[model samples]
Target: MKVQNKIVVVTGGGSGLGRELVLALLSSGASVAAMDINAAGLEETVALAGMNRGNLATYALNITDRAAVEALPEQVIARFGAVDGIINNAGVIQPFVRLKDLDYAAIDRVMNVNLFGTLYMTKAFLPHLLARPEAHITNISSMGGFLPVPGQTIYGASKAAVKLLTEGLSSELLGTNVRVTVVLPGAMGTNIAVNSGVMDTLEVKGGEAPVKMLAPDKAARIIIDGIENNRFRVLVGADARLMDAVYRLNPQRAARFIYDQMKALLPQ
Candidate 1:
């Protein structure tokens, strides 16, 4: 579906790729409702839109809250007239530790924010999207969802669940007006560690040959293009694209390669 004139809601719109998506959508003539937990960040996103600010609305929301997510459709419609698409972009990572060392509270937090959050938002807005003549839903998974990273096992698990959930949703919505797309993003230049509150415990160190992370703006563009074309899966960054092929050809080798690269961060 084309984005022009459509009203779309994006979670995690305070910063990172989510913020970029809001800006891109506005530039493409789409009205956006940017939702995030950080009010200041949302304000900053709108401010960055400048003249296009009128096409954007900011909402400070915790997507994990089912009641709040369920109520969002009405609020968004009141602000933007109608909801045509939703991007479930908010997520968190687990601490850099083995699952044996990881606490239940931390595991629960990751699952709640990453998996349940996406599920809640999808369920809440699916009806509204189906009502639209052309609508789309985009869920952001991660490269870790397909390949294993030693220290980020739980985070990978959460994202892997999202990968399946999105694919299943796409299959189920096949006959409907709503289109579902899942995004698998590689490492990107974003403050996800800070946002996930894992910065102190988890430091992403560069290897001997450092991998260049993709920019948020570029990632956003790729995602938007996928949505416009109603693609079932969107892979962001060269790393993500490479892994997609690697995983398909040899899943075990791909998992081992990632484990070797990331095992340094794990507890010795």
Candidate 2:
């Protein structure tokens, strides 16, 4: 899809990759509606957008709230006439813990924000997307979606769901003008760990993390390219692409390899 002058709504646009994407889209001449549960973060994103008042708008929203998400299309249509695309980027990561050791509330939190939230947003916006001659949906899955790690069982599950769900959407939307793209991003320099409340309890933190992390701007560039080119699956960063290859070669062996790598990352 051509991004220039198109209306795009990005959930989690307040910070991290979402924030970077909003700025990147603005720079590319796209009109953007930065949606996030974090009102302050949305404001910060707007401030960084810099002198693009005509093309940028901020909406504080909880993507997990079904009613509000359902209302978003109308809101966007009211302001921008129509939407060309949506980036389902709102997500949260649970603290590192095995499934057996994890609390019910933590699991619920992760599933609610990471999985169901995307579902809600997709369902809400799909009808409107169908109205357009061509439309794009970008769902942010994770490297964990392809290769599960030991400590992040719930998060891995949620992202894996996103991966499959988006793939399925692609199949169902075939013959239509809508396209679905799922993005699996490797570890990047962002506040997702901190904002999701996992940083404080992360077993490994800082200094040469196991996966090579990219700056959000770099990731954003790759993502925008995928959307413009209508890629079905976008793997961000070398680590993500490498692991995707490993999993495709042998899912069992890849899972075991990732577990061993995770064990090595833990503090002695």
RMSD of each predicted structure: 1.5, 1.6
- Candidate 1 has an lDDT of 0.91
lDDT of each: 0.91, 0.89
Error of 1 at 144 (Å): 1.1
Off by over 4 Å in 1: 204-210
Model 1 error, position 165 (Å)? 0.9
Candidate 2 global CA lDDT score: 0.89
| Worst 10-residue lDDT window, candidate 2 | 203-212
Residue 104's lDDT within candidate 1 is: 99
* TM-score, predicted candidate 2 vs. hidden true structure: 0.95
Best by lDDT: 1
